[model samples]
Target: MKDFPSCFGESGVQVADFSSSTSRTAQNLVSCVYQCRLRGRSRLITVSWSKNLMGQGFSVGIDDNTNQCLCKVDIKPWLFSKKKGSKSLEADSSKIDIIWDLSSAKFGSGPEPLEGFYLGIVFERRMILLLGDMRKEAFKKTSATPVPSDPIFIAKREHIFGKKIFSTKVQFCDNGQLHDLVIECDTSAVSDPCLMIRVDSQTVMQVKRLRWKFRGNNTILVDGLAVEVFWDVHNWLFGTSLGNAVFMFKTNPSAEKLWVSQPLSDPHMLPWSWSQRFQDSQSQCLGFSLILYAWKNE
Candidate 1:
């Protein structure tokens, strides 16, 4: 009997051990999750959206040397299903009558090549999203941009309903220059609903109205400005909004304080009339953290 780490959090489940008999080399592990423990012990649960593989399911394993507990189970086989034609076939059905396609074809290829898994671990009041595989080196090179260690705050806006982020914008004063950074999520959308930004340890001027246009037709407009820079940001908020939200913070360099403004507004001029139908609002501030997830282009 192995002494496993005590499970924490409201989930009431602890992950004891996980492993796959299939070679981890040829196949890329897409995602893994530890579901509610079985019989009060951690049960390994995993999801692999791979096309090439078979016997795709969760597996459980224990470390023999450590006397740790382990379990393995196959959820579903990765076998393709074929549909028979309408013709009434005799006892000997031709194999050609059935179509052979990857089991994942039903869902369609999501991104491409099915890259390795990216794990976001939040432990002991800290958050870190680890990017795995060959892409790790590339991420390091691109993220080398000098980001402030003690940043006043960080915001990560993800599209809850949509396929991906419509746009990402960052506003901050760097070396006396007020800079605005924007990136389009998908060019075809022409506008984005979600927006996020972070400010370093510097106070911002407070005003009634602030506006800016980024890559997409998306525009941000904000009212009211307040500032406070402490506490992890994640615990303070929740919900799915496609607009800007104001976060207040005080700068270490200035006693007067400043506002870190994010304008969340509708993209009125977007080609799709449905775009106007989308609502823009802000959720409560959950908390704050400096760590965020970034992907490397292949």
Candidate 2:
């Protein structure tokens, strides 16, 4: 099989491990979550980018506060004949339009474009979510008014592959500087297994006795904001299958509110409880989370 590079190539790797067969062909995906108001009610938007042997593609989904999907649209991979187009959909009796132009877009090694393109989501001719650098072209093509309130980026989930060193880029807050996130761990070193996490080459967190503390949470400050880090590497340490490790970085002071029903004082308790359901909002304010699933290359 041939190896193809994605447009944004921060962190993506493939291994030849067939121990479980499932981990041998893990899907490459990047999903970004945004919080915004729709018809006076809070809603969430998920934009997912994906790539496979066929080509690069993307999907846009809208969900209500109740966690119900209101609408979704998928743009087939670069079809050559339709690199730029628009689609209109209806949700809750309201009109929604999605437009994009990737003809000249440049990509790194990831499925996401690096520049030269724009993806716009308009509601009633009003721009709701506009991404990419081609802002002027997007407005002219969609004939949309400037956004009244900017959407808040709340979360991002991405899959990465590597051997012992995995790296990616992240921004803790809107308009914040993008920092390099690097995770180094050698699971094969059973005698002295350790884990280290660094941001912008600066070591922010480290773990010893990997076998004992495979699941835990810690806090680190970034850009003057407190970020709680949760990790689960139990699979890498002891699982029979070649599994992936999960890591989440949350940047919300009110994040503790999500665990109000749980035992906060218990040192052995995990805030997320190894579950992927972390959508609790007690306050009107939105929070941000970055989840990375790191898979080791055989």
Candidate 3:
């Protein structure tokens, strides 16, 4: 199996279909729908409430080969009452947890489900880093915390090497220049993790470190940063950021240039219209609709 990409690259998972009602004198009412997709299938697995008082929620996982239910798990909370002030409280109190075993499941058998193909994990000795927006104070506090000794699970087997993450992008950087590894820890439960890059004589070390401050509501963070040594021409292309915008530095480390696609104002214009000359050879020519609108007082 392939190694999983860090959470920094993982796409967001969203839960939908929640409805509730409550009275001023009572607890808040809540009901929600959770949906998950089965690997390699067009079917979407949905879990929701049942009208029966004893039946809190039900979950279903589909098998693509059979086009039938692979597993059906009932989630009945230990306690539930319609008269209760909050529907969510009742559901939570009566909910059941179920873990599925797919060893004998058909997801990975036969032709191998398109969504269930496990990509080979690619490991690199170089340290990984990330950078993004974060609260200034939180960043400072985390920086002062002591590093931890435990191994950090950057990605789960199902997430990185699993068959689910297909056609997704992965980026890696290894520059010789030292950089501050910044990360934003959003919850009090999770300690901010760090990557320590060090080199001695001929050996290179990438250490996993941790910080103390609880990230709180801050969602943006500078994951990590590094300056790479130029070894070969191919390495140069892969060493830089993979996004559309990147900062390039000169040999002196004093001069820098901002490389960006020229802004296109015409609503009908395609992204290729604004491509820089250097990117023309490597870029794909794709057209997309561009909408522009502004509100005006009548």
All candidates: TM-score: 0.21, 0.84, 0.16
**lDDT by residue (tens digit), candidate 1, 1-298:** 1111111111222221212213222232232222222222322222223323442322222211112223222223342132111111111121101111122222212211223322221212121122223334323433422212211122221211123331222332211233332221331233323234323322232221122222211112222222232211121122122232222222212222212222222111112111111111012221221111222121
Minimum summed lDDT over a 10-residue window in model 2 is located at 1-10
Ranking by TM-score: 2, 1, 3
The best-first sequence of candidates by lDDT reads 2, 1, 3
Relative to the unseen true structure, what is the C-alpha lDDT of residue 218 in candidate 3, on a scale of 0 to 100?
12
Candidate 3 lDDT tens digits, 86-172:
111111123212222212222221112213111110002111111112223222422322112211111111110111111111122
User: Of 1 and 3, which scores higher on TM-score?
Assistant: 1
- For candidate 3, the lDDT comes to 0.20
Using lDDT as the measure, the top candidate is 2
Cα miss at 76, model 2 (Å)?
3.1
Of the candidates numbered 2 and 3, which has the greater lDDT value? 2
